[model samples]
Target chain A: MIGAVPARDATLAERLRAGRSPRRRAVDRAGRGLALAATLACVVPLAAVLFFVVAKGAGALNLDLLTKPAKALGTGGGALQSWLGTVQMVGLATLIAVPVGIAAGIYVSEFAGHRAARAIRFASDVMVGVPSILVGIFVYVLLVLPFRQFNAFAGSVALAVIIVPVIQRTTEEVLGLVPRELREGSLALGVPSWRTTLSVVLPTARAGVLTGVMLGVARAAGETAPLLFTALGSRLVNIGGFGEPMDSLTLFIYNGARSPIAALNDQAWGAALLLLLLVLGINVSVRLRSMGGVRA
Target chain B: MREDPVEMSVAAPVAAPPEPQREALPTAPSTVPGGAPLSLAPPAAGIPGAAPATVPAAKIEIRDLNLYYGPFRAVRDVSMGIAANQITAIIGPSGCGKSTFLRSINRMHELTRHASMDGQVLLDGVDVYSPEVDAVDLRRFVGMVFQRPNPFPTMSIYDNVVAGLRLGGGARKADLDEVVERCLRAAGLWDEVKDKLRAGGTSLSGGQQQRLCIARALAVDPEVILMDEPASALDPVATLRIEELMLELRGRFTIVIVTHNMQQASRVSDFTAFFSMGEDRAGYLVEMDRTARIFTNPREKLTEDYVSGRFG
Candidate 1:
């Protein structure tokens, strides 16, 4: 620490001088300052958005928003139907996508031989970049036209299509991260390749895979473009089935924000806050799981 | 498949008639006469391969083996007979394909993409390369412990021990407890781990985890256990413990180990095989002999130099 050389600061100054020059110290301080500024730049906008939504919406956001319906629009109406529809469609989408995405991921990372896997990988990367509105249009043509209706099932199909590629990519990357040593150990015990994957490989990558699923859910929950042509929106509190048109927070927010009524706009802001909370909750829980969850 | 003396003699056991064909088969076995070798091969410190004139009963017969990682031949034309219930150590410098030779015995080498092998590895004198012999089944009888201790992080100690039996097929629900205890006991881990059987395998100390892996290998009751520098990642005491455990396991399973530690080879192995990379970068067997003879009086100059630490 160069304790013998310093007089004014009892060796602190000498230690600092020995470790880093003045220019290097200044550079380090500047680098730290830049990093903090960058972090704040990201966080400030998010905080502002969250605060704005809550401030405008908190009055309308009550228990009635969950339990009651938006029966009297342009009045103090709740969005019970919209919330339920959002839950149903997102649930269906998750159900449809999770298994298929994880399976595709396993195929790409584990048994994928040569060019076919590469092509599938390439396709998934491209899929992630396709415009969300374009995906909505694609689903509209495929499902809405085929069924001759804008139904909850069609909405779910759109969300699932968007979610599948994201989850699959994450599963592939995390599964690939599992060290080859474990595979060999399992195989050396005479475990078949499929069983090894199921029992050992999949479990090891479980947290990361779950993170992917949650990320997909968050992304799909916030999407308004895909739902515009699928679920459309309805005033009914409880739609009969997947065949019926559904009401979602995003769709309601989209329709209400442009309305002239102040009450309707307040309800839209309330729905946005609820949707934001749901997405943020999923993301936060996923990060928590990733930090200290059961890892193989 | 060709009716060579070794193949013809070995084939009799697999295809023997139910009645009396087995009686005549054991009389003139190629590796041993009357099949006493597997049971009666006494454990003496490095005595099994002591005499160059007397060859032990070969449990595994690897002939003209070549291993390739794509176009790059990692190991070339290597042939060695591993004795039944005896420890054989393959010692060499880094990238010498000693570990490759070890992995190819159970076909673990084939797991890598584009990895290919040309040759025959006979287990109980049956060609493992034959299409009829499933690699999965071959691995059941010929197990391997890696250089790094890889206890399944997802599993408890009890589960990790019985992982082989569970996933490797032939595990009965009723026998799981017994099998886990037996394998752990055999691996010299029962006394330390019996109380916390439900604890995660990864929570154990490094040596304990390695032992847990060994226990996992033993869960399926393999006849041959291949170790690739099993103690390299361990501390000195752990290394000594593992070496001692190998000595104790000698008469139960045929052991083939790859080690960079020459003292360990001298201390633990019955037979020592030296591998060196040629100018082509393909590893070849330089010499195979009794540990005592190879360490003291060697045939190959390369073996002597390596043993003396004159050069890698």
Candidate 2:
């Protein structure tokens, strides 16, 4: 029976008995090569930016730039005061934003079955889509105008407004990613719904939630527009309360970049590099934590 | 001329009269032993307060049960008595309410938002549908195995088996370990999985996953077990294993299974109930009888036609 068929007349199965044909095989190889080329094309620009930042900024980085006060407009300077102001303002913003944002996200994901929940979710989405500059203007009106001056507290409020949407959206998405089956299983076991959410669902989605928080920090850390109208860029950092004007890394970069002196320009690059490194570190740590969760 | 001479000495025995034979036929019309006329009548007259003479007092009784999804009635007036420690298999084709009926027994149907039922499901002489009876407690006494094996993917095999027991309340470590081992052994999965009890339940093969589900169900120590197409998703070998396990479990728990496999019903069940869709496409119980008689000599022509593979 096998011998009755001609070699070329073999069954379709026999034709496919080996692997791919030479022409098709070559095509597959070419397809893979094209994919690799496209990937390299996308990565090259990022690599160039990093290289440029390191080359220019590395020359200006020093302990003095980190530890001393900023110089006046005509002289060589430092970022110590700017760094302290950035820390205080951002810290306060984070403290205000994280809890409220996360709570709102949880409510939307877990309990928002009614019209109020729908309204909150819709409002949050709209807020997130709104321009950051608009948020700064709103905060400028609400806090800076009423107070009759730009202060650290006004800056923090602007930053908080921006941070809220980022944190809220991320938290909601992460909580939504937790499987419904897990929640159902917990509830079926006689655990109260809220307890199940807190102990089971939240714990399972913790890695994603942490990643969201990190992203929120990274976003709020580099915001310049909101800080401009609120903090108003003081040359020397003042570590006082809501009434005192403050300086941050972003404002320092903005101001130094606009200065006529070569020293100020150099200082801007150094501060930019510092901000980049902090954001990068946060991102990498979040990635590592997420991977650790998956492995476990 | 020879026949005439031979007939002269012949004498024949007289046959009985037709009237006597007719009278005897009425008396022998299959007496249901304990012989209650009321029990023999159709359920349309409604079962009286007197105990059902057709079967022993039901371990589980469903009455005037109607299930709906939105406005569509999926099942209507499904009343049946499930006897204790017996394997009762509900067999029907697709879309026939066998699975729905099984789910309603433990109120698992309540999980669907659009689903609703008007009924009374009694367990051990108490109405499970009563407002005072907790659904969670009902589920504890009447456990279910779904068509597909859904052992929680995140939980380990050991945890999957102990989930129900732990959910019941506090269990000592020694007692838990013993119960887990016993349930696994009862499911015929202990030897294969004992060494890897800590492995995720999802890592098991399809057959092993089904067995793990059975083990999970057994861990709760349910008095009645409801299985909805438990072996339908399994291969022939796995199906056989589940059939064997059902037979073994029948010694302890009342097992009510819904299956499309007639051969499986005949092989495992002592009693079989046949269901079919009515004119409205709503499912109803057509007939129920001893497994052997249902297949060989069904009283309902519809059942005989279905069992004989002439129609479904």
Candidate 3:
């Protein structure tokens, strides 16, 4: 406006000409079909899995299935031990993983020099790629044999090792999303670096960090291979004290799903449903909190 | 790009939230100073410039300063003396290092990796670049407002204003209320926001948010306030309001502003420094003079070209 130039005539490209050519419409149709195929390719499998799982497990659930312990190798039993054991180990692992993981994330994102932080982040990404079974074995040898017994604690240690890198990497990435302006605003107030990170950076990224934490917890909860060598499933509802063998839904499903017994098969379906629900619950809660934060 | 703060329509329903009041801001929160948290309606004696001991001297002196980002030298040896309780405007085209020079006052440029500098920034004749002078404490005496309005998205309006005090710690509620009102009043934002102090800082309009950022800076009672294109994102009306607030703030805080608008520099500043980058693209000051002289009759040909809109 200040320069005072006259408006030019509209170019052909700008005069509502998009999607008018026959070739354009054909390309558009192709793109739509391909995208639909891709979407269905993913959604079909997921929907089938949900349907099959529900169909198989729906009739299997009763109060007994949840409240009673497995008897005679998961035949005519409720899977109570597996439920309790899954809760304990996942809960324990989350307790151990969350603090250390978040701290490492903060250090990598905020404090470490570029090269050093990159090295750590690279290691974390590689750690994520490491086979879960190998993590189980590493913990099995380091924790299990040294403690001279199988125990829930050993399983927790293994799960926590697997969870740490995921949460740490996620936290670093999520914290990175917090704009530099907020960090500068805090620091420019004469607030110390540490205080700035805690009060401003962390709080600003609260919803995202919670997503990372929940993802780690959900991952640790359902893992079968990691607990296989460490937890060593039990039939009774033991608290699975530090050195005691424990039970988990994944352990139950792995062994039961392969068996010929009809009752054990049904129990496996129920266990799968339960684990799926738990993960779903965690994901839904994360979404709700994120939405609430935005709305507020 | 400049915007004109479009005044809201005069005809409004009864339930609408309070708009910016044109008349005088609500009186002193209508309560005693340092008393309760203004229950019904709705105060900076400790401010650095208030003392005669600290007045009438150069507040900040930048000497032989060079700033670098890794191997690229962005700013070359530039020197300037800023008088206390006066507004100095820094004007330049884009990428001219005016913003970089402003950031050096509070040592904010050092926050980025590989950003290094060689300079002496003296506050009250004490070198801020010396190892013993903590950057954190130095910022309290010299505050900054950014080009874009960046109120913390998570914090409420009142929280954003008092954030500096809370970070310093040991502040009572009564003290916080007083600072909030005083700072908001100084920024010319008290009347629009006092009722919705608990609302998110981001809920305010763009112009109001910029003013909120100003209030946040003023709450620290900074000896010097550095603003980097503070009105660049606002409407013309909002820009004018900020300009008026700058004049009102004269004598309470030594102000240094970086702006691209030559008219704004001529209108508001007591002294004007013109900066431009040369062949190597490293910005350096071309001229520094009283505002009237710089705008009407500058000694440097480059300054004349920039001011007369012949060249940038």
TM-score-best of 2 and 3: 3
Candidate 3 local lDDT, residue A284: 92
Interface RMSD (Å), each candidate?
1.7, 4.1, 2.0
Docking class of 1: medium
Query: If both were scored by TM-score, which would come out higher, candidate 1 or candidate 2?
Result: 1
DockQ, structure candidate 2: 0.09
Q: Which ten residues in a row have the lowest lDDT in candidate 2 chain B?
A: B9-18
What's the C-alpha lDDT at position A172 in model 1?
95
CA lDDT of each candidate? 0.82, 0.75, 0.79
Please give the lDDT score at residue B290 for candidate 2. Answer: 64
The digit string of per-residue lDDT tens for model 3 on B1-312 reads 001112221122222232223112242211222232221111111111112211123566777889988999889888676655568899988998999889988999999788899978877667899999999988877888988988888889998998877875624566678778777877889999989988999999989999999898877666688999999999999999999888777655678999989899888887788999988999988877667878998878888899999887
Instruction: List, residue by residue over B9-95, the lDDT tens digit for candidate 2.
Output: 111111111121212113321232233332322242232222343543356777788988878888878777765666889988789
Q: Which candidate leads the pack in lDDT?
A: 1
Q: What does candidate 2's lDDT look like per residue over A1-296, in tens digits?
A: 24333378778787667455666767889999999999999999999878877888888778888888876656666888887888788888889998988888888888776687778878888987787788888888988898798899988988888788778877888889887656555444434456556766676677777777787778888889888888887878588666878999999889889988788899988888887887788689777766642222
* Per-residue C-alpha lDDT of model 1 across residues B1-312, encoded as one tens digit per residue: 111112212113222222222122242223442233332122321222233323366677777899999999999988667776678999998999999889999998888789999987877668898999999998888999998999988889988988887887777788688777777767789999999898889999999999999988877777789999999999999999899778777756778999999999999988788899999999998877767878998878887898999998
* Model 3 C-alpha lDDT per residue in residues A195-228, reported as the tens digit of each score: 8888888878888788888889888987989898
Error of 1 at B47 (Å): 18
iRMS of candidate 1, Å: 1.7
